[model samples]
Target: MTNMDTLWLAPALVCYALSAVIFIAGRLTRTSRASGWAIYLLGAGVIFHALDLTARGFQAGNIPVGNFAQALSFFAWLTALASLLLIVRLQMAVIGAYSVGVVAATLGASAIMMKGGRIVLPASLQSVWLPIHVTLAILGFSMFVLASSVSLVYLAYESQLKAKRPLGPASERPPSLEKLDRINYSLLGWGFALLSLAIITGAIWADATWGHFWSWEPVESWSLTIWILYAALLEARLTVGWRGRRAAALTIVVFLVLVGSFVGVSLIDPGKHGGWFG
Candidate 1:
């Protein structure tokens, strides 16, 4: 990458690092102030990430959605942005640690992958559906990640309560169990909707470029698997009255599937989407 093209990485990494530190501090001290700082840092990181994506797009003379580094960077920014919005709307600063941790992991992986190779976009990827498909997918994935984080916290809190253990101030920082459940479902609803849109747009793009809507590419298969799992989770919640520990467990499982599709499948197969890892 050119110096100008890569300049955004410096600030992005710095902000992520700062956000991580603040998150850890907040977790350790059980203070909301540190979490607030983390939220601010995450916002700064998102801005830098946007600049980086914009620079790469200009350099490529098209949207930079074909490569792993760009996709991961975009995903990280979307997650951070979603987390920031949640914090602002729900006043739940306690989840900052988990959100920042996710961002750090994604960006760190992208940086390593970038050092290994350069991304080369294909002509087929240049289309109107590229942005639509990518944006929806990233947003859906971000919501799933957030839901997973909250589910984790819920399990931990529930365990502490069951064991009659003192969770200190940290336990008090998150919302109530009912509230957490509501938030998880809300995120699931939005995530599922976006994911459906992503799938449809991807199919349309496939048809436009390859004369077929479904080809069973490795990435496509994994994405469909994830979608099916989430769909099942939503159905269970609605039809079987799934909630509390059961719902949380199901969400955790679905989120694992989502991560597998996002990272593990890419690493293991690296099929047509291999250009993304470059």
Candidate 2:
């Protein structure tokens, strides 16, 4: 990484840390000022994150997706961006703590894994479809992640209500179950659409580079599994009138599958996609 890249990392870390604190404060104090601070911090982080991505692109002379570290960093920022947009729309600053934590963890992991060695892009990843596929896939994943977080929060809030307990710091100010359910559905819809687009682009890229569109590679298989899970969740929500706890539980399962696809596959069976981290 260049000096420019390293410089951006500091600002990004600071933003995430500050956002996390502000989010917690907002939830605990029920103060709009805390949420406002979170928004500011998130905006600063996004700017720095964009700068970092630009630096990487400049270094690569193309869209950079060669190694694992870059992919992780990109996905982290994508998640942060998606979460911030949702927070703005929903006015749910309570979710900021979880979202910022995810950003910080991913960024820290990427920093640890990032090697300074230059990587040559695989021939198969050179087509225009590469960018579309990656962007959509990352966006889809981000949405799913956000949905999962909201589901978890919903469950926690429900538990508190059932027990008639006082709300804790994190649970002090949360949206209603109905609102969380609606957000989850919206995220699922958006995520499913993006996932479909990603799969289509992946198929096209595969055909262009490898002469085949569907090879059932490990990464491909796992991604398909996640897609199917989310599809089922959506169907259940619409047809079965699944809501509240049931819907949140299903979303939790889907997110677990997503995590397995992202982390488990890489560890269990290294394949063409194994080079993502290195």
Count of clashing residue pairs in every prediction: 2, 3
What tens-digit string does per-residue lDDT give for candidate 2 at 96-180? Answer: 7777778878878887887775566766566677678888998888888888888877887788888998454563456787898
When summed lDDT is taken over every stretch of 10 residues in candidate 1, the lowest stretch is 112-121
Task: State the TM-score for model 2.
Answer: 0.91
TM-score of each: 0.91, 0.91
Each model's lDDT: 0.80, 0.80
| Residue pairs whose backbone atoms clash in candidate 1 | 67-276, 68-276
Q: Give a tens-digit lDDT track for model 1, residues 1-278.
A: 56865688779978987897788687677666567668788889989988987877776666676577778878888898888888778976767778778888888877766642234467777778888888999889999988887787778767877899756666465678788888888988899999999989989888888899998988888888888888888899999999877888899998887776667777788776676755
Candidate 1 versus truth, CA RMSD in Å, comes to 2.3
